[model samples]
Target chain A: MGVIFLHTLNRMRGTMLGWGLSLAGVAILFMTFFEDIATQADTLKRLMQSYPPEVLALFGAIQDLSTPQGFLGMYFFSSMPLILGIFAVLAGSGLLLQDEEEGVLDLLLAHPIDRAQLFLGRLLGMMVVTAGILAIAFAGIALSTQWAGIDTAIVELAKSFITLYVQLFFLSAFSLMLSLLMPGRSTAAMTSGLLLFVAYFINSLSSEVESLRQAARFTPMHYYQGAQAIGEPLDWGSLLGLLGLGLVFLAVAWWRWRARDIRITGEGAWSWRGLLVRSRGSSA
Target chain B: MRSIEGNAKTLDDPMQIPAIEIKGLTKSYGRVQALRGVDLEVRQVEIFGFLGPNGAGKTTAIRCMLDLIRPDGGELRVLGMDPRRQSVEVRERTGYLPGELSLYPNLTARGMLRLLNSLRRHRADPATIESLAERLALDLDTPIKNLSKGNKQKAGLLQALMHRPELLILDEPTLGLDPLMQKEVLQILREARAAGTTVFFSSHNISEVEEVADRVGIIRKGRVVEVLEPESLWDRSLRRVRVRFRKAVDPQRVAEAPGVTLLDGSDGTSVVLQVTGEMGGLIRVLAQLPVRDLETERPTLEEIFLALYRNDEED
Candidate 1:
């Protein structure tokens, strides 16, 4: 298990660094504009009032941008989950599916390691990389807080990043589960990507649209703290719920991986008929 | 059915377990049946060659032996242990080279080998890997993606042999190699056999099998058609004899010969006769014909393979 875990981590080092540096750069860039955004807070607040309340809710309404908490919320935390969710979905869906599709998983499984061990090793590796990337981004945000003279507590900012990590974990696990259930990597990724956006929009729109309110509760985005974590205490219930659901998804993925045959390249494809008639023990 | 009864070990001989044993093994992909009741037993320390064409269940059977794919209905035991129940234990002692080999394209051959070696409970000795690489003429530092097809194949072979496993299951072990390299791989397999490693390798190349295997199993359309010693294939294969007579000859006389069938007689003076089993009777019959020149063509292993398949179809 440790061997597979270390190898998985080694393989993803480049991806982790790329995502970490890009997000961190974005965080720094956003913080550079903090002072200017704060100076125009009053004007911006009035301008925001003129716009439709639904439009304001789309980007997480900035009630008072003059404060560091509101400024960071409106600019950074609001969009962080959606941006990072893309990485999560791609990484999770591709982690094992890509290897299987490329025909390497057969060789790897031929080793002494069992399917469960391989699955757990890769999952743990991805989780560690995800947390590492979030930490890198958080470091940039924390450093820029001093340069930009924003008076928010570092602990408060860390809490927001933690919330972001949980949301990403849920998204990653969901993608991993879908990859096992779906026919191929593209189908899984597309489904996960589409769901992420749809859930975000539904949750965002539900704030003003009464029809989507009940539907929002079903979306993972509803449980995500996002910018709301900046000033308030941690949402333990939401965090634990997302974490628990992620574990459930992971378990299902592991079970499916263990039961089904590993497919050779170009042997199978997505088919509605296949889906309906496919046996539980058969490969897609 | 030609089973391995002659080499079968009994409970009285508990120490001489067959390296691999499969009975009534069946597998299917959707409606395409890959293996249909394949029963085979490979005795210890022998190079067993599985000969079959594309989609003939060679790979499927090998995968089932490794427990990579579950058999729909069958029994499989490797090294006297049930593969399905003790897969890890089976794999720990077995080394497999997949038919379509895939490696981490980004890693150097050495790095990839190291990673695989680390996964084994009994890690391969670094000196053994270096020795195998040198013998195979493989560069340890080249990334897998940068290697040519033959080099990649060499890398696959090196990994499989590095651990010096008790049983080596290779699919197309000689695929994509030059003739010289092919011979080198056969030599390597010979060495493994000499070291008491049971080698079960699948190939479509009949000559490679004939050159190295002690016993050969021919499969077609998901069924094991025949299992015999390599020498018997020569005995059973048909030979074509072209007899050119000095003058027009009586074709009926030649056709009536034992174990001989007149295949073609386009010209009056010459006839093509296919001989099965023995040719002595035909030669004696032809000795009576007007003094003539004769040419005998030995059948290739491929023709022999097709004949076996045809025989199976007839049955």
Candidate 2:
């Protein structure tokens, strides 16, 4: 298990470096404009008020445009989940499926290690990589806050990044589980990507569109802190619930993969029709 | 044909357990049955060759023994342990080379091997790996994606032999090698057997198996049709003889000879006969005829294999 974990981490070093630098660069870019936005705060506030309520609802009620939290929240934090979620979904779905599709999993599984150990080792490795990238991005945000002389507590920034980390972890876990049940990695990634978009839109539009309010509660986006974490206390119930759901998905993926047949490349793609037919025949 | 069960009981040490024992094993993919009641026993410390043509369930049976694929019914034991219940232990003592080998293309051969070695309880000796690579003529620094098919096959063989397991199961181990490398691989297998490793390999190459395997098992249509010594196959294979007589003679004389069949008597001076086993009887019969010239052709291993399968179907 330790060997597999270490090997997984080593293999993912390139992904860590690439995504890490890109996210940090984006954070720095976002921070540089904070002072300019603050100087025109009065003019922008009047301009924002002139727009319809529906338009304002999309960015989430801008309470105080002049504050650093409000400025960052409106522009940066609103799209952070979707930005990080792309990496999460792709990595989670590809972690095992890539090897399986490339035909290397059979050789790896032939070793003395059991399936459970391999699953958990790779999962832990991915979680660490996710955390590492998030930390790099946070460091950029912190250094930029000091440079710009923004008045926000460092602890509050840490809290917001923690919420972001948990959100990305949950999406990753969900995608991993779907990869086992779906036909292939692309299908799993596409489904998860579509769900992420839909959830974000539903949650963002719920304030203005009353009909979507109830459905918005069911999406993972509903529990996300977004800009709220920068000023308010942490929401323990939502944080823990997302964390617990991620565990459940991980557990289910492990159960299915332990006994599932590791397929050869180009043998056949697993599909719902084939599964259902087999199920019916067995039941009959 | 000698039965595997009978051979198992006649081993030098009666108390010695077989390296692999499969009973009434069966597997299916959707509607296609891959294995049907496959019963085989491979004794310890011998080179056992499994011979079967394409789609004959050779890979499927090998996969079941290693617990790579679950059998629909029946039982399998590897190294005296149940594969399903103690798979990790079974794997710990066994080394396998998959039929279609796949490796991490991004990693160099050395790096990939190190990763595999780390998975086992006892790591392979670096000296042993270096020697195996030298013997196989494989470049350790080359990435797998850059290696040729034959080189990739050499890499696969090195990993399987590096750990020195008690039992080795290789499926088509020499598929893409040059003739010289194939011979080298056979020598390696012989050396492994000398060190008391039970070698169970599957291949459709008859002469290769005939040269190295102590015993050979023939599988057809998901069943073990025969298990016998390789020498026995040579004994049963047919040989063709053609003779030119100095004068006209009756073809019936040669037809009545033991193990000889008169295939052609078109001209008055020539006769063609197919002989099975020894040619002693035909030679004696020919001495009486007015012979001028004689020629004979040996049967190929492929022809012998087809004959065996055809005989099995007849039975």
Candidate 3:
């Protein structure tokens, strides 16, 4: 388990700089939201009057981006999920595949651990990284809120952030499954990207398209409607749904990994994308 | 099928049981048979070599033994336990180096070793790891990404050997190392064997196997053709003589000769004959022909191995 965790953490080490920068951006937005609540909301409200109602729906009907909940939704939920979703996807894209590429998959599997243990250990590692990112974001948001003299429920905000981070477990699991089943990183990345995009789109479309509201239940992010969460208290149903989906993805990942044969290639001329395409062609 | 009762010829006491025993193990990848009833045995304290070509069943058999892939049919036992049923136990006693060396590039060599060591219940000694690092000339501080290929292999060897398991299963162990490092690795294996570690290694590198292996198993197209003591196999086909005669040799007379092959008598002025088995009979037969120049060459592992594979293909 430690081996898998360390390996997964090692992969994300290269992207820590980018993660810090992105968190900084989120911090700036968090600060701006509070400052606006104190002094700029009135002026912003007057300016926002020019925008159509449809535009509000498109961005999730934000009546007030100045309030803490509204601000958290706009900064953390609205854009952050997609951004962090990408982070989750990209961070996990090589969790299993990279070992296969390095030709170390055989070496690792040769140890006493089973496929389930390896998968779950790696998933736990990704969960830790995600939890750390969310913790950092929570701290940043909490500090910024206090620094701006906008005192809302920091615990409540932390809870929401924790929930979203928990949601990311499912996203990470899905990405891991794609990483294992798909031959290459790019293929896994593209698949995870498409899945995340579609999940987000379905979550949004669930509100607009009457039929899709129920249909979107199939997607993992359908449970993480941040707009609704900010307006209301919380939704346990969606949380459980995402959690179940994560477990299902994990099971699928384990099963697929058990069946698949990882081809060991060391610094070959063929890139991951090329391998994916080549494998696809060969199979077809 | 029931166990072959009499076939169980114990080479030594019950304490000297093999670390790994594979019998009639078969694995197929769609149309291609990767391992076809390959039987092998690695004695408790000897360095066993599974020598074969690239596509042969060496890797497949190793994977099966590790329980990485389920064999289609046959019996396999590691530490007298079924690999499929008791892989976890088998793996605890086994240290394997994959044919292709791949390690996490982001972690420093020490970090990677520490992590793998943490995974095992019986942690490897830090002193042992550090000593191995020093001996292999591997930098513990260097991230694997920064290390050259040879350094990565050294790190892998260090990590695998650090715990000092009862069995070391190395596949193409000397692939990336220089001659000196290769010699160092061989020395390490010898020392490990001396310490009562059973080393089951796979390689096509003849010299490496010749240097370390007590017994060699030759595999071809997923089948184990032969598992013989290296010395006996080496000595089995040593006597061979080839001669080019000054005058054309009668094909009928050469064929009738005890152990001489009239390879070609069509070149009327120069006859070439191939002889095997009896050097004395070949010497007598060559005396009858007006021999001009003679040359003899020892058959290489490549020749013997290729011939074995070719014969298997024919059969």
Better of 1 and 2 by lDDT: 1
lDDT tens readout by residue for model 3, B293-313: 877765665665654356666
Q: Among the candidates, what TM-score does chain A have in each?
A: 0.93, 0.91, 0.80
Instruction: Please report the candidate that would top DockQ against the real structure.
Output: 1
- Model 1 segments beyond 4 Å from truth? A266-270, A273-284, B1-15, B239-260, B268-306
CAPRI grade, predicted model 2: medium
Superposed Cα deviation of residue B2, candidate 3 (Å):
47
lDDT per residue (tens digit) for residues A1-284 in model 2? 89888988898888888888888888789789878878888888899899997788777776666787787678767788888899999999988888888878888888898888889899989999999888888888889888888888989988888888899999999999999888888989999999998998888889889999999999887898867898799999999999999999988888778767777743435576778998999999
Clashing residue pairs found in predicted model 3: none
Per residue, candidate 1 scores C-alpha lDDT tens digits across A107-226 of 988888888889989999999999989988889889998887778788988999899999999999999999999988989999999999999888888999999999999988788776
> lDDT per prediction?
0.86, 0.85, 0.73
- Clashing pairs in model 1, backbone N/Cα/C closer than 3 A: none
lDDT of 3 by residue, A173-213 (tens): 88887776665777888999998887777666666667777
TM-score of chain B of 2: 0.83
- What 10-residue stretch in candidate 3 chain A is worst by lDDT? A262-271
Q: What are the clashing pairs of model 2?
A: none
